[model samples]
Target chain A: MIYRIRTIAALTIREAARRRLLAALVGITVAMVGLSAWGFDRLAHGGALTSGESTLALPQSLILFMFMFSFVVALSASAIASPSVASEIESGVLMTVVTRPIRRGEVIIGKWLGLAALLAGYAAAVSVLEMGVVDWVSGYLPPNPVLTTVYLFAEGLLLLTLALLLSTRMSTLAAGVVGIALFGAAWLAGVVGFLGTTFGIGALRTIGRISRVVLPTDGLWHGAIYYLEPPSLLRAHSLGQNENPFFTRSPPSWVYLAWVGVWFVAVLGAAILSFDRREI
Target chain B: MWQASSAESDGLVAAGGVPQATAPGEGAATTGSPRPSVSPAIHTLGLHKRYRRTVAVKSLSVSVGRGEIFGFLGPNGAGKTTVIKMLLGLVKPTAGEAMVLGAPVGDRRTRRRIGYLPEMFRFQPWLTAAEVLRLHCRLLELPRPSWEQSISESLETVGLAERAGDRVAGFSKGMQQRLGLGVALLGGPALVFLDEPTSALDPVGRHHVRQITRDLRERGVTVFLNTHLLAEAEQLCDRVAVLDKGAVVASGSLSELLGRHSRVRLKLSAAPAGWTTGLSAFGAWRTEGEWTTVEGVDPDAIADLVNLIVAGGGRVEAVIPEHQNLEERFLELLQEK
Candidate 1:
């Protein structure tokens, strides 16, 4: 079983590469990173500001860039992993593979591992490159770059798990659409919660808490935001910057992180079970 | 209940039209010595499946002995694929028991000895032919050292050895089919289920598939084949079962079915009055001048028929066996259902 799962994982990764999904994601990321580096150079040396002034501006702007990358990661993860299981079942590939000695759970786990690795690798590489360029241009790096990237990778895998679960019982397009929509909804609720915290409203705060518990993308995304805080943002928040949507107040608690882990395992288990019971 | 009908099918396989299979391992059991009995490669008792109001398979009880080419014939929407899926553990049967390779269906260990080629015959298009085979080698858990050799031999057997390096995206329909066969042939499984293995192939490809199937049988591998091409089944199958409305309508050895439905034509030179009435004991008879055509008797009974005529003071000029076409026989059986 171990050998079978490893083989399946390797084959899936090879499939993603062969289909050029990995290449496309990498290409778009490189273009984005290059553009960001050029923008940072202009801000620092193109008469817009001094290096010190630009470094001061880097925190919020860097958060914005990371936010964009998060969206890219989420979308890519949804599109790629959503179709992995559903399309194979649709095209009759599952019919052939499952007849072997391998179990259905192995296919699900293998696909999950393969896709998780791809999305995580993409998320980490792009985060590191973007942060590196910002650091090179202005000597300003996020205080917790590694944790931020890890959170970002976790966010992508979270969406991937949900999308893969939906794929077990739905069409590829349906699963992707539903996954992206939920991500949007969760993030919106998180913003609402942030507003509630700013205005001392308990109902909206509870809504955010419930939404995050329901689906942890926004919760994890907020943690990524918290970790991506540059020293300038930290000083500003220390002097009171709680009203900013980009300014997360603190890292996710152990309870929320535990919930995310539980949610991931549960959804993945459901996907495997659904696939095992499916007639195809 | 499972092995009752499978290990011994004397009750399920009554005389006449209902299919009767050879006892499992009867072929290898040399006469005068106790037979080394091996479980049938596939056994199902009252296997049934239903989806809401749709009944896919109903009471599909059949047994396939080892090393035999058993053809599963059915029309579209007759649940042929469903039965195959159930037997392969891809889909669970609603009710009944199925054993493959001496264990219940869906046994992962037992699956190591079984191979299946689905009707769709799809493989990962991104993988090369050799990569596809190697992936299955890993899935089947074949020895790591034998992976390359197995891929080479399987590709050569399926006539895709030269294209082993090409990705499936570039393969033609015929090439894909041969590659599918190559994938199925990996690991040297004890039993293989081939669903329309030749559906996408041309004449030469079909012939090649036939030869490969025969060779597998020669190697003591049981092949459960599902095909719409009756002509192909006629040429390849050792025994067959025809399914209609998700039930076994007719099944038996190819020769038994063809012979049982054959028309025995006899030309008489002498005479006994009302000899045509005696034909009723055999089957319906039609007389044309001195020639009489008899239908629906075992072909082996033709000799007894000749003796009857000779004892009745009638001289027999000729006895010719005109076996019915399997295609026609299947059509008649389905229409009867």
Candidate 2:
């Protein structure tokens, strides 16, 4: 089983590497890195009088930019994970491999590992480049940088797992589209939940909680925001008083993080089960 | 239920030796041998599959002997592929059981020793032929040391060695088909399921495939071949099953199926008026000019014809026994339904 999983993982990575989409994703990452570098350098050295207010706003601004990159990670994971399984099922390419000695669970896990590695590398590389640029120009860094980077990857992983579950039951296009739509809807619900909390509306607050439970991408991103925001910025604009979608008032609790892990395992288990029972 | 019918009808097996069960290993047991009998390579007992309202395979039971090339013949929608899938563990049977290589169907360990080339298979286009073999080797968990030599030999077997470095995306349909064959032959599996293995090949390639199949059998491998081409089956198969409407309509040795309906053509001179009446013992006879034909003449009836022709003062110019090819036998069987 171990050998089969490893073989599948290695082949999956090789397959992804040979695709044009990987090249496109790499190019997009490079352009985003370059753009962030130039933008930060201009902000730092423009001599528009380096004021205390701008320095104070640095963490908030950086979180906003990283949030954009997190969206890229989520989109990339959704794009790759769905088609990885669904297209093979549709095209009959998986018939030879699945009929071998390996268990269906091994195939699913191997694929998950491959996609996880790819998404993790992308998240780490982009986060490091963006953080390095912010530090080089403004000499400001977010608190708990490592934790922030992990949270961002967790967001991508959540989407990846969700997309895989969808692929077991639907077409590639339907899985991809539904995955991204859910991600977007969850983020909007999270924002609305913040508004409800501020305005004392119970129904709206419950909507956000339910959406997070259904799809944890937004919840994971909020955890990332909470980790990436500066201490002063977080203290000044307590989440309820702030309108910024990129900031979190408090770090997600230990229980929530545990649920994220549980959510991942449950969904991944469901995917393996569905795929095993599927006709092809 | 079906095995009982086969046992009763198989007078030759019972009369020639012992009463034999079609089930594998039973023949050896009835002969009082406990020396670890080699079971038939494939054995199915009333195997069946259904997709919602439609029954894909219904009560299929056949045993293929080891080292024999077993052909599965069926028309469109006759469930040949479904039966293959069930035996290979690619699909689950709705009822009954199948055993391949003495293990239950869908047994993962047994699958390790079996190779398959599905109809209309397409390898990953990005991988070169060598890389594809490597991937399959790894997937099959064949030891690392054996893969390099195996890949080379397999590619050479399918005549794809020169194109090993070329990506499958650039391959023609025939080349891809050859590569698929190479994949199936890799790791020296004990049994190979080849579905329409020659569907896309030219005549030469088809000949190469047939030769490879024969070579595999020579090396003690069992091949369960599913094909629409009866000539291929007739040339290679030791036994065959014809499936229609998801049921086994007919199955036996090629000669057994075709010989039951044999026809003999006779050209005679020196007329005897009552010769035609004597030939009635050989089933139905038709005469035109000096040529006479007898349809459905069994082996016993042929002797009567020769004796009557010689004793009646008729000159037997020539007697030709006509054998029906597989295509004709297949069509005749289908029409019988």
Candidate 3:
């Protein structure tokens, strides 16, 4: 089993590393980070709001940068993770490996490990670069930059896993689009839920709670971003607000985290079952 | 045990539908041999595979023997590739089961003893030919010491030794196919499945692959080849199964199937105005221009016809028995179905 996993991981990493999509992803990430740095520089120097003002100052800038970063990260990671296995199956490369003395679950797990590793590495590198720029220009840093980086990386990994699961049953194009759509919708629903909680709107809160449960990409991002940014920033813009009765904290409670883990396993299990039945 | 051997021999002859002349000391050949006496290397019982609503393989059952090169012949979309995939466990059958070496297919242990080369094989573009082979060796759990030598030997076998270091992306389509073949053979599997292995090759390359396949057979490998190239099948296959519309239309030793539909043709210097009447005893005879054609005729009857024609003052040109070529036989089977 270990040997099969290693082989599957090696194959996935080698194939993905050679794809033109990876290069494009890296380039886009760098450009996004660079653009964020430039925009933050102008905002810091303009002095429209004092650095001490949490709503319109450093906190807002940090939240805005993280939100933008998450989109790019999700986009790139989803793009890579989505096609990594499906394209292989379509091209007959998977046939070569799958027909060997390896189990189907081992193949899927190997690909998941490899893509997760890639997402983690990419998220770390880009987050570090963005932190460096923020420190260089704003002369302020988040209290727990490492924690924030870890959270962002974990969110990226989770999104990638979702994309991989979708990929097993759908075309690469459709999987990517659906993955991105789910990510966007979940985040939007979370935001709506937060507003409903703050404004005491019951129906909106229920809708947000259900969407977050269905697709936890947004919930994960919220937990990660809240953990990464300054407490003052999170408090000022109502950013840390969790509207759902199920998750009243900015980051999920232990129970919610456990539920998320269960969700991952269940979705992945379904994906593997679907793939095993596929005709190839 | 010796009695078991005799029973197995009888079973083989019966299952194969052709009797073999027992050679001296052949009974001793069964002892201490890696080959099994009972179960065939591969067996499918009414296997059916469907894609969505379309049936790709329907109730196809066949068995391949150890150390035999079994060619699966069919036109495009005739389930030849589907059956091979099912045997290799790359595709699941909608109904029935495929057994490899007496174990159910899709079983990991069964797959360990099998190798496969898919049609239009695609490899990781960044990998060199040697890297790809080494990776396969690693996956197959070949010993560390054997990796380098096996990689080199596999490349050498495929005539790609000189280009071992070259990235597969830089190689031509035919080169990639050859590399795929090398990967399949690297593990030294006892049973190999090759789908259209020579479909993309030139005539010379095709000949090279055919020779390699024959070499594998000589080394006691069971080869299941799926190809539309009947001529190559005729040359390389000991036995063949012709599939049409998701069913096996005909199967058995090449000679047995071809011999069943024998044709005899005669060329005459003078058109024997009534050759049909003269050759009526030779079975159904037809005159197409200057040639007289007879079907279902024995060799002795053909010789008799020649003698009678010469004795009847009709000059005999040439008496040639027109054997059914693989292509002709394939078409006839397809049309018959």
Maximum-lDDT candidate:
1
Q: What is the lDDT of residue B141 in candidate 1?
A: 88
Model 1 chain B lowest lDDT segment of ten: B27-36
- Ordered from best to worst TM-score, the candidate numbers read 2, 1, 3
**lDDT, model 1, position B176:** 84
What proportion of the true contacts does each candidate reproduce?
A: 0.91, 0.79, 0.81
If scored against the real structure, what TM-score would every candidate get?
0.89, 0.90, 0.88
| lDDT agreement with native, every candidate | 0.83, 0.82, 0.77
Better of 1 and 3 by TM-score: 1
Residue A242 CA displacement from its true place in model 2, Å: 5.9
Per-residue accuracy of model 2 over A170-221 as CA lDDT, tens digit each: 9999999999998999999988887887688999889888888888788888
Docking class of 2: medium
Q: List the candidates ranked by DockQ, beginning with the highest.
A: 1, 2, 3
Best by TM-score: 2
TM-score of candidate 2 against the unseen true structure = 0.90
Where is model 1 more than 4 Å wrong at Cα? Answer: A49-56, A198-202, A238-244, B1-37, B265-319
lDDT of 1 at A279: 78
Q: Write the per-residue lDDT of candidate 1 for residues A96-186, one digit (tens) a residue.
A: 7988888899999999999998988898899889999988986778889999999999999999999999999999999999999999999
CAPRI band for model 3: medium
Of candidates 3 and 1, the better by lDDT: 1
Model 1 scores a C-alpha lDDT of 0.83
Candidate with the greatest DockQ versus the true structure: 1
